[model samples]
Target: MALTDDVTSCLIDNNKLFKDIIYTAQYTATSANHLGYNDSSKHNSSSNSSNSSNSKPLPPCFDLKDAYRTQAFATTTVPHDIENPSVKRIQRRLVDKFLLTMRSFISSLLSLPILALLVSVAIYKTTVLHLQSSGDQRHHSMDEKKEALDELLSQDETYYIRRWGYACDTHQVLTPDGYILKMHRIYKKGPPEPSQGAKDTKKKPPVLLGHGLFQCSGAFVLNEEKSLAFMLVDAGYDVWVGNNRSIAGFGHISLSHKDHEYWNWGLKELGVYDFCSMVDHVKVHSQVDKVAYIGHSQGNAQAFVALSLCPEIADSLSCFIALAPAVYAGELVKNFPLSLLIGLNDWFYTLLFGNGCFLPIMSVAQQIIGPKIFCFMAYSMFSYLFNWWDHHWLRRRKAKYFQFTPRPVSVRLISDWISGWGRQGVLLYVQSPPPPPPPQQQQDGYRATSMTTTTVSSMPLPLSAVGSKRKLPLVVFYGTADYLVDGQKFVEKVQTCNPFPMLDLVHVERLEGYEHMDTIWGHDNHITTYPIILDQLSKVSYP
Candidate 1:
């Protein structure tokens, strides 16, 4: 971005005159079906000027050493309707109507579940009112009926902490870039009793758990007593689960929900700023020089970014474990429905709400009413997109899901991934002007010349971590039947990424019966995955 553009954006941000759409996304394809290549023009012209004189050569597959030697973001523009204003307008309007129709339709489909849950509560309430069998039920009968069910579904961080008996503490960690994220910590196992001596009086080595895309720390504990976060506390690791910046309940210290700047961030910031800062905070608080890192789903994406972009912190990591990791977007067209949805992500987003926050209302609704049709719709979409779910496990834990799953995330981030180019071989500007003056500055004239793009010539890896002399321990775990990840292909891509990747040791664990989320939330993760994870962490510590 030009210094002048920075000044102008800062001015706009201060006066709040800017629109929230991702302007840089003009290169975004009309349809998501374009092979996941970012347009070649996305890189800063100046950064790639020398190569501009000669036709650019094709990039190799994602070799960390070869990922982004020059500042370039490669992208391939698909057949979008942006060039025709009239058609674009029609497209967006048509899409908006369709989305509304779909939402209403989904509500109709999911209403059965909602109605069933509501009716059950009503019956329980009526029965208690008449029989007065238990004191707790009698007290409940007196409270307003409508408010009771809403309140039941809307439990917060504190409620879960108390319910499972985990010792809890809260921390507000400020990022270098000035975003203040609220973080939750578990120092001891729950069912807190006077005789509970499980927690070591001395601080244990820190272990940070990052939630999945759109989700908060709640996912780690949705299974209640059997949750991963609670289990970690039992194992004597000081557990910290964080809510990344773009999540529903999260916000930057300076940016308001209303500020366009709040929408400026994508997945990059979630990893580069949010996850990294929280790691620093935990180290200082626990006085532990190294910590174990576990990322579930997209959380793994952020950790990969941390290991790649911030090489200086390599030694700070004792180990990196990814559960249901989604590091590659290779051969996505194979998963036609998911690819199509992602391919048209931008168009649908444009049609639905034109580049601001994605589903902000849904975020609020989930919090206020707890789980409802909207949450059901979101989860159902996932079930269709990735069908390896163990039906039996879900049926057993059915009640916990509605109240716990479906986190709100920015559509911009989701759109980026669907683009394919965004995650696989994305290149970005090497230099950006100093961050615009905070909310206080009024500024003017900046022309951004960076033309970012993405190309998946190789598997994704950080330049530094790819070649690190001090290897970070890495364990990649996945569910065998998960379409979200091409399990076999991922292994092949990793082996081809480098002759020897920087990790001191790498282990790939693929399990049957488990799907994407089961690695972390399965009732038996303690029996299946946790032992491997703990064993890996122990190896790192002992080594």
Candidate 2:
């Protein structure tokens, strides 16, 4: 009873009326136990005490049980059978408490597994997305490598042979030093009926085509669409493409036994000896006092060299067209890769290439990978950096031409052009000034000094001093976005030479989006830049 009172008081304080009623029921059960109400203890001492306490003598315990039974019977017999309000309230409270306990237990049981499943799904999705992005980047890199290789191999070859279609014969020009140079004569037909015999019967002057370093005369003629030779031929000029020594057509020339070392000569020797020989040969063969000269890249370098050393060549040049001229090699230093490449060990390259030519290895690589790989490689290395869409425009405007090669040239020749020029050669010319001799001692002694000096300063005269009274008219064109040549510096170098006043200060202009090779090979060159040169050429008159 005391425990009941305590429980009841705690529940009442908390305002839990249903809990108080349950505690009261528990107290009643405890009281019954204390009274010895087991079935076996029918006439127990507790029962006797209850009987003695009664006022009337108890007949028997059975009689008392009978009396109680009679009372329960009477109560059952009553008409209205109403349930107790406390009992109903207690039952409703029990049901609610059971439900609350069941809900809490069920929620606790489900929470752990549900949380684990959500975490797993999130991790899986993140992993899958990362893998997909990596795969895409790899695929893109591979595709680019494939495309670059193809373009290199797809260049035109037939164009070179086409320019030689009118060749009377191919002859080897032997040098005094025993080096042999190859020469091809392209015959010309008489001009278009001389405009119905209008008195003047002078024959048209022959136009000579000169290719650049690491390239042969074929380079000029190979691209039919953008071939310089083709353009001149179309313009009614007798086109003759000159292959420099050590290139595809001219590589086999036999050097004089006295100067077997001459084959080691780079552009320095090419300018002094090779170009001069070609010009003299062309003049004799064409029977013309002067010829129109068009030189591209390295060819332009040779032209300047020949004119500087042999100023009389200026008289032989009626007009000159320099395409992507490469007179001052210093201008190319602005290109990062080009500078690195030029600065590399020339001898190491010679050892790897053996003969110093690259085309053979490039050709082999192209054949192994196929055209698609070549194109992809080209696009990846060159496109994004140089904005090749503009280059595509330049190439599209020109005729498509193929390149042909008999075999690879020696890498030594290329090394000479890249390393021997500009840095090494220019420094030598600047540092070691040639000794000044009496005017009488200049002529014969000058030739002797030029022949004997192994250093750069003692080498042949600068190409800028082509004619006695006039410097060769220098015109330079480059792309502003070009990754190869510095267009601005190139223009400035020409201005330093102080060209003719009638000649513009500098002819340097940049193609919007052209690269190193794209100046000539690009599709838009024909439309955007070629016309400018053609217009200038049209105004030039031969004496």
Candidate 3:
């Protein structure tokens, strides 16, 4: 009788605990085929004891991770109450409705662009053939021309690097937050002769290049020898290119792309985990005390935010070179449709588009359209969005440029940018409180030692830990005509506002006719911008 009583009490306790967990748990939707609970007929068919009178109803779909469940209680076979089945039925219906609506919306949205691209491709081919027949014929055969075009459309970054007589190595960096990022290291094909009075090949300083929003490391090498990556390699500096986690695909130690939790991050996580891990990896691999960092557009924002949160990593940087810095987007916030979309609050946004990757159909379409057609479509979209014209880019390399960009980004990352736009700052998603007493800092064009001696891994510094006194050399290149971000304003604010203290604004240049992407992809950038960047890098690294 005592054993029976104890068993009853135990079952009651477990049942109550299980109920609490289930009620509080957050549920994510999977397909009806993937989730057994969503398909009652299948579940009923699979059950052996369906006819048994003593058998209890099965629990509603529980999507909680293992961390949420207590081991002892997890094994407890508790059944659902009468109310849960109906609730779950409603949930399943709502999920189905939501997914169907999203799919329909996406399909409708994509149809126009897909149709436009098809037409554009047809016209592009017609024009090429017309040009060939209209006395524009070259000595090369049609097959050769097609072969060259195919190579341009299909080659990856490593292909270009090796083609340009350089060696490229791929390294996988594991972030503290379980993300695995792929990085590229570029060097000359053979052992580089020791520079005059240098120790050996190892003495060559390392420069890390980070790409802009929706771009991968491939952007740095797309322009062949004229690209910044190749230029740096030719200038006798080791070049390493950094990529975000979702560049090629969703890379994580434990989470698959299908998992909702995998997409639950924003620019904050990028700065904290991505930058920290990549910087450390570069520092350790190069066998150097510090690395010179260069970033363009959103790439610049990541570094700035990373420095703000984790001052300790500043020790690993020799200097920072920002190309079209995206710190202050005050003017950009006023742009059409984008302004309207960004104005929506988080809950409403998630309600409208579920919490997943942002505009996944774009990726799907990109894959389906093939590289050549996708490149034409990408150019059209960029031209419309940014008011950029074909004249802004190097004409010959334009197709190659589009082949690499517009990689997958999370909806949360875009939300984080919107949040920052509201604040009119680059400090994404984090409210900036009044900082402590300003540390003794150096002014423009001066170089100082690193701020902190403490080496950190993965963890960001606390807010109280701001105000490092060290001077980190910074060089800025901004386009006067660039409407995407107010780079001039970013320079002004960092110099005057004194946001953390280590930022030493050394040199500032305003390119008169340049636009946002002109810093890297413009025809004259190799002659006009690359030399100046090389000079700054050399000053900090060799000094």
Give TM-scores for every candidate, taking all chains together and pairing residue i with residue i.
0.61, 0.51, 0.68
The candidate that wins on TM-score is: 3
Q: Estimate candidate 1's alpha-carbon lDDT, on a 0 to 1 scale.
A: 0.52
* Residue 379 error, candidate 3, Å: 1.6
Model 1, stretches more than 4 Å misplaced? 1-152, 189-203, 248-250, 330-333, 345-351, 367-375, 388-396, 421-468
Candidate number with the higher TM-score (2 or 3): 3
Q: What is the C-alpha lDDT of each candidate?
A: 0.52, 0.43, 0.62
lDDT (Cα, 0-100) at 57 in candidate 3: 19
Rank the candidate models, highest TM-score first.
3, 1, 2
Q: Per-residue lDDT tens digits of candidate 2, residues 1-543?
A: 123343344543544433232233233333433554332121222122221121111122232223221222121111111112232112237787676456444533453354344335534543454456544433124322432222333443432444334233354443222234555544433444445464435445677767755456555544433555555655556666666654533232222212222234444346545665566556655667666677766777677655544455576666666655564443445444455555555433333333323434344543465455443333333332222232233222122222222223434345544543534433111122244455565443433121111111222222223354543344456655553334444444433332222223213445555555555655445666666656555555655
Q: Among all windows of ten consecutive residues in candidate 2, which has the lowest summed lDDT?
A: 448-457
The better-scoring model by lDDT among 1 and 3 is 3
Ranked candidates (lDDT, high to low): 3, 1, 2
Q: Tell me the TM-score of model 1.
A: 0.61
lDDT digits (tens) for residues 299-397 of candidate 1: 877776555555555666788887876665434435545554544433333444334456555556656663555444444544554553433243334
**TM-score of candidate 2 against the unseen true structure:** 0.51
Residue-wise lDDT of candidate 3 within 278-364, one digit each (tens)?
776676667677889999888878888777766666777899999988777746567654565566644455544445567676677
Candidate 2 — what's its lDDT?
A: 0.43
